[model samples]
Target: MDAASSLGIDKIGFASAEPFTELKDILLRHREKGFESGFEEPDIEKRVNPELSFESPKSIISIAVAYPSKLPNPPRSEPGAYRGIISRSSWGSDYHDVLRDRLAKLEAFIAERVPDARLMSMVDTGVLVDRAVAERAGIGWSGKNCAVITPEWGSWVYLGDMITNIPFTPDTSIMDQCGDCTICIDACPTGALVGPGQLNSSRCISFITQTKGYIDDEYKRKIGNRIYGCDTCQIVCPKNKGMNWTHQPELQPDPEKVKPLLIPLLTMTNKEFKEQYGRIAASWRGKKPIQRNAIIALGNFRDQSAVPILSELLLADPRPEIRATCAWALGRIGGEEASSALNNAQAKEQEPAVRQDIEKAITAVSQSASR
Candidate 1:
């Protein structure tokens, strides 16, 4: 339960390790499955390294940490054409930190018994497909939303692995419970869930947050107000109903990050950005990607207050991506002040792309003012 609490998992689920006798057999079968055939081999080597030797790993243990919390909807938007927004994850600290710590503790406990055993741990590294291992360990099956869904904790959990040289007993595998239901795939806003189990990670908002560098206007306009990750499919999952997973007490955000206003995030210096978000998972993409997201969110908000911040960004920021985004946000605000600033900025801006963005802002602002 300590691990569950740390992971913000409402309830924890355990899967026994598979016996060493079966390890070689399973590994062989999974290797034969291969990627070229449109099937991903569940073998750790294929998942992590094409050349990993299976002879060394004696056993694999899988664990599930659940994170289920009902989100209280944000206050309603004021009148005008608008779009909806969603919270990243309602209950906890970033799952990566919470789960990794618990796995570290578990490794220590195992080391006490098997002194010379080698151990490895991973959480959402993408190299090892987590859901497959969880399913094999009987923790849960990969649900339609592509999340591991256990009967006890629903689908809001993180999966982790501990591969050790010491042998242990493995648990039975779980069966897929999704019976022809395509709600998760159908409900995706950007159609990222192209099929029942297929996800185009490139088109995912969660992926967008992690992707480095600037985003084009086409992608920016569609992201809405999501400044971090996206959770539309997870919320729509029928299995996620009423699972009050425990919240990670330690993952509380720096007040600045918990409720970040779009304006200040764009203006933050590398030093200020480090001071504010350095410890969090969101810092990986550095300040620019987040600033880009913030600009998009401000555009979606169409809040007049964002106009000055956008204006300041046009003149002061060094990144051309940010300047273009500032123009986009100003255009969305569409007021006399925003338009005049954009018009003036366009003349002085040297980058063709940025100048084009400024001209686009002038047109959108003029049109909005006319209406």
Candidate 2:
């Protein structure tokens, strides 16, 4: 624990490597309800049993690193200069790298004590459920928002863990503090939080933003100005009120990159996108999803000034998702130029899906103009 504290780990706890029986049922129900985000490992046995990760695993060590919640001197978003926000989780340098480095250091420290100590470490990509491990290891209680909430740091922390052959004293789990609190569920824009501690990932704006295809029209307006993940559930949680952690320097947000101008993002090339957002976690899905979401944000803002660039994208952009989203944005902006662009796109657009999008956008613009 002393070594972990010295290595800048905010919280650490140990747990027995016994199979997670309770989680299996929960996950089974999650699958039955079609709530999975498709990011999880498909094999349920590997997910529930720590033994699958390592031979003779006796204990697991869970660690948490607090990340910053607030950005300093954030750029202002006005009518002409609309900006889209990347969630707090994706604000800093990729947390996977940061957490992996810390875990490697922790492993080295343990190896020094137990020569020939066998260990397997993992971050978010690992098959093991991080929040489940953290909860069992007493790092924090799982919140109704599905976040592991540490009393000291709220839910603003990155989690990682290691499975080890060495037996260790298991810490007691924290008592649930989300009693009678329906704030996160009530605040969900899309009603993705179906119940306490339950999430319908299909409707989650965070998951919706990461999807590659054209977003559903129903969710388009609800996405608001989020370019990456949505933080509405976390922001509304009472436990997270007034909680901000800025201790880890690597976790601090670069205001401009995290909250960037929406207009510039539409025309960004692959190389340009990589150079700017390559190090952040949100860039994992690449530029397509982000660009698509940026177009949606422009529509949500209804910024008439964006109509020109959006019209250009509708005519010239090669990606159907981009072209289609631009049509939607232009329709929302609704002007003579925007309507003309949609009509032109309807005439020339070859892809059936994109053509339908153009037609729908034309109708939307016509309806708005009528009002």
Candidate 3:
């Protein structure tokens, strides 16, 4: 614990490296139901078995580093100047890098204590289910929203773990406190929270935002101003209320970068996107998804000021996804100019899918104008 605190880990707990049999069955069911986000490890056995990751693993060390939830003095988004939001998780420096560094330090500390200890550490990308480890290690109880709810930091902590050959004292699992609470499920705009503790990733706005191609029409409005990820579930969780940790300086968010102006994102070049969002975790999927979501957000805002830019994208953007999304946005922000842009795009669009989008957009704009 002393070593972990020195290494900047907010909390550390140990658990026996037992096979996660319960989790395996749950994951199999999750797959059968088509609820997975497709980012999970395909090999169920490999994910549940710690021995596969480390030779004769006896203990698992789960660490939690709390990140800031509240952005101090965040910039305001007004009528003509709307901004899109990245989730609180992606606001600061990339957490994968931050957690990995802390884990490396912890690994070194353990190595010094036991020179022959074999240790294998992993962050988010690792095959191990990080939350499962954290829960077993008594870092927190798994919440109804599918987040590990630590008492100190609520669900705002980043989780990572290390499997070791040493048999350390295990910690008791924390008691679940989310009984009878269904705020997260009710608050999900897309109905992604299928049930308490169960999520339908396909219907999730966060997952939809990360998708590279054109978003389905049904989910666009629900996505609102979220460009990268969604925080509705967490934000609504009672446990997370009044929880904001800003202890880590590197984890602090830059207000401008996190809550960026939506219209300007449409015009960003590849180089500009990299330079601006490179350090944030939201950049992992690249700029196309963010730009696509920005278009959707502008439409949701009905910001007529963005009509000009959306029109330009509709006419000039080479990517079919971008052009189609622009058409959809312009259709939502319906006006004579937006209607004209959609009509022009529909005439020139060669792609069957894009043409369909443009045609539908023209009809939508017409209907909105009628109302």
Across residues 20-65, which tens digit of lDDT does each residue of candidate 1 receive?
3333454455345431222244454456431253346756667776
Pairs that collide, model 2: none
Residue range 1-371, candidate 3, lDDT tens digits: 78788899999999999999999998898899999998888898999999887789999999999999899999999999999999999978999999999999998888998999999999988999999999999999998788999998899999999999999999999999998988999999988888877889999888888989978999999889999889999999999999999889899999999999998898898899999999889999999999999999999999999999999989999999999999888888999999999988887889888888898899998898788
lDDT for model 2 comes to 0.93
Model 3 has a clash total of 0
* Segments in model 2 whose C-alpha atoms lie over 4 Å from true places: none
Give the per-residue lDDT digits (tens) of candidate 2, residues 248-347: 9888999999999999998898999999999999999999999999999999999988998999999998899899899888888898999999998888
User: Model 2, 193: alpha-carbon shift in Å?
Assistant: 0.5
Question: How displaced is residue 151 in candidate 3, in Å?
Answer: 1.0
- Arranged by lDDT, best first: 2, 3, 1
Tell me how far candidate 2 lies from the true structure as C-alpha RMSD in angstroms. 0.8
In model 1, the clashing pairs are: 9-66, 10-245, 10-246, 17-169, 17-170, 18-170
TM-score of each: 0.81, 0.99, 0.98
Alpha carbon lDDT of residue 129, candidate 3? Answer: 95
Of the candidates shown, which would achieve the greatest lDDT relative to the real structure?
Answer: 2
Clashes of each: 6, 0, 0
Worst 10 residues of 3 by lDDT: 190-199
Candidate 3: lDDT of 152? Answer: 87
The superposed Cα distance between candidate 3 and the true structure at residue 250, in angstroms, equals: 0.5
